[model samples]
Target: MDDQHTPADTPESEERSALRRVAGLSTDLTDVAEVEYRKLRLERVVLVGVWTSGTAEEAESSLAELAALAETAGAEVRDGVVQRRRKPDPATYIGSGKAEELRELVVAAEADTVVCDGELSPSQLVHLEDVVGVKVVDRTALILDIFAQHAKTREGKAQVALAQMRYMLPRLRGWGQSMSRQMGGGGGGGMATRGPGETKIETDRRQINQRMAKLRREIAELATGREVKREERRRRQVLSVALAGYTNAGKSSLLNQLTGAGVLVWNALFATLDTTVRRAETPSGRTYTVADTVGFVRHLPHHLVEAFRSTIDEVADAHLVLHVVDGTHPDPAAQLDAVRKVLREVGAGGVTEVVVVNKADAADPAVVARLLDEEPGSIAVSARTGQGIDELRALVDRLLPHPEVEVEAMVPYTEGGLVARAHQEGGVLAEEHTAQGTRLTARVSPELASALRAYPDYEGSAST
Candidate 1:
């Protein structure tokens, strides 16, 4: 968690500050709820969820997360309610009886919106909204709105826009009979149009499909640039570590703390959408890359996963994954499960992972102890306080993969570039000065080994 700062006067700072209004600030437990809702611009919302599975505590936590998401989207959560059920009612999600109950709560709470904890079908959304007499938003829509507001980069904005369009495509609604009319120029509008003509909903869907196709092509082009950079790093034999975890798990803060990357850190969920890569060094000065990617959430919108597939590959391709868990969150175990679920979905389930229990200073001692016990070898560290960071860095160095090829060579001083590459791309096992040049023995990539082998006079033993 990071403290809120006053905005500066520059254009860049102004943009960052405008977003700050939507990003919630970290606050004490007593006033944490108030901190998130203070800037709400009359978007009062009543939260509703159906507890189908899991314990009562998990149900409560899920709704709590929904409230946090609502607040993050600039909505005030007036009240929350959960209905017990074997499964969600197909028609209205929470059923007619509970819908009425929710209506009463919304009316009493003076909320103008009803936010559901699950993704509602188009019909369910309409029925529930009609019964509740307010604008109803499901979890998927709420998350998409947040992404739209927080995305800063061109790629990020394109991804979010594509996702929102996908979600809205099937839910295109039309008013009574007005949108059911035939097109005016239907006489020459072809076979189907010559009959009843194209309806308003049909026209809207066609336009949306066209727009979606264009967006897909744009996103693909942007992803190509990202792939090029990733491939370049691979050619250099640089190891990459990606941060993967639940939203607001203090990943950005941890990244800044470790490498002084200066990324913006916020206390809000899904605050960072664009992937940020920073150069990092281990205890022995071995160079590797650490990336702060978008955070995961329970039931994250499927459209988002599809739209951000290119970005999510950062984790799948990483040499190591730092699975950061918010030690202070009420249900850390559930958070862990949620993150790993998405990891598996992205084909990153088998990647080497290091569980990092963050916010140790704020987390309850018992909670931290239990997490550490459950996740053996997990490290408890506070980005805010710099606790246990040295140990964590050393551990990362030991766990990361090293170069496979080893060699010993003495080269002329003109090849000092090779020495630097040896230190950066691989490990320097030994080094000594010599009259001829520098004698070195180290583990290196096969490509680097080939380069080093070019020197005939300074040749030495080579092994896999």
Candidate 2:
């Protein structure tokens, strides 16, 4: 994860003072007391995956990422294995032979847990557990575990729980060691060492599902408020531009550069899961809202997407998207495709995209050259060095929506409200004072133009 997603800030320092508003920090366990306590300790885990396609190197990289995720979730990866299969076996995920091999690997490594690289059906999970005689978790569960550990805000926690419950719903099994408690009945030289069984797991699943429903209602209420906020911005005609990219693609770095958002740019997957928006001014002196959204990844769990639909909808509604890319990534092309796939999944497929190849300072020139050659209009820049930023800014100015009409208007001094609204909601090119009224040359949105037309004192002909 360190090598994958580092802070993309430049040394010349695009850093700015922290803003006054406190918002969107996740409620994950990062805030828990650091003192010694009796919480669960990290366990030894064996990583497993089935390779259906892709080069051996690609498969290895994917497994390496899974390892990083395990570490992030406070697990030690003891060993790993990959089984080549066209489709994961319904019963064991991997073939039975591979399962036996994996069991041996776990025993050899003394691993307490097995983590799979793909989501497994409930039956598959139960079968695998029975075969391996260890805790079996699929990729979605692992990702959710990471989210549960990392979420810091109330909303973040609620969302993570909702997603987890949805994923666990179908996988609820009738038997589990965590369920049946030892009844301790039959004694007399023949004591039974019974354990928790599946019934408890089923009950837990039901409770989780109930809680999930409640959370959905709560989030729906929150979404109402969000919609109101969005409408307010729309009423103000402030163009919203969302920054989206693969996890740790220097999005926060670029946001900090463009808008002075002091978002913590860390070297970790899902560093900025919560959305951060800041006021930004383009080179042409037009003001707009810029939002840095949660970074995406390949094969992001579907439940996560469903749970985060409201949050991701922000991307769909954006007037323009700044698709940040790590120029130094081994496969920038693949990274770009992953992002695009998520965008399409979220129903934001047709939105305008500006491919931003970030980290120019550290990126291989050959990669940069090839990317530039392939993507005709993509901008290559070192967010840390501010290289090519000016050009990027100009591109932003060109891409963002603006007022359609350039006209001169005269208004009475008393109508300062109109004047201020014009400056705030529309682009005011020039202003002057005369004895009869205030003279202004401005570029105004069509909607604002209609509103101005209704004013009784509206004067000054169009400057066509």
Per model, how many backbone clashes are there?
0, 18
lDDT of 2 by residue, 1-464 (tens): 55543333543222211111112211123435631241557778888887779876676667777777777677767777666566789899986766887788789878889999899988899889889899999899989998887677666777888998888788766545656754434533343634433356666776887888899998898778878988898877888899999987999989988988887887777866777779988775677888887778778899888888888888898999989999988788888998899889999989998889999999999999898888878999987889998898899888887787766667678877777767755678878787867787777887767656554334445333
Give per-residue lDDT, candidate 1, residue 181. 68
Best prediction by lDDT: 1
Off by over 4 Å in 1: 1-40, 176-178, 184-193, 456-464
* TM-scores for every candidate against the unseen true structure: 0.89, 0.81
Report each candidate's C-alpha RMSD, comma-separated, in the order given: 11.8, 12.9
For model 2 the local lDDT of residue 87 reads 76
RMSD of model 2 against the true structure:
12.9
- In model 1, how large is the Cα lDDT of residue 315? 94
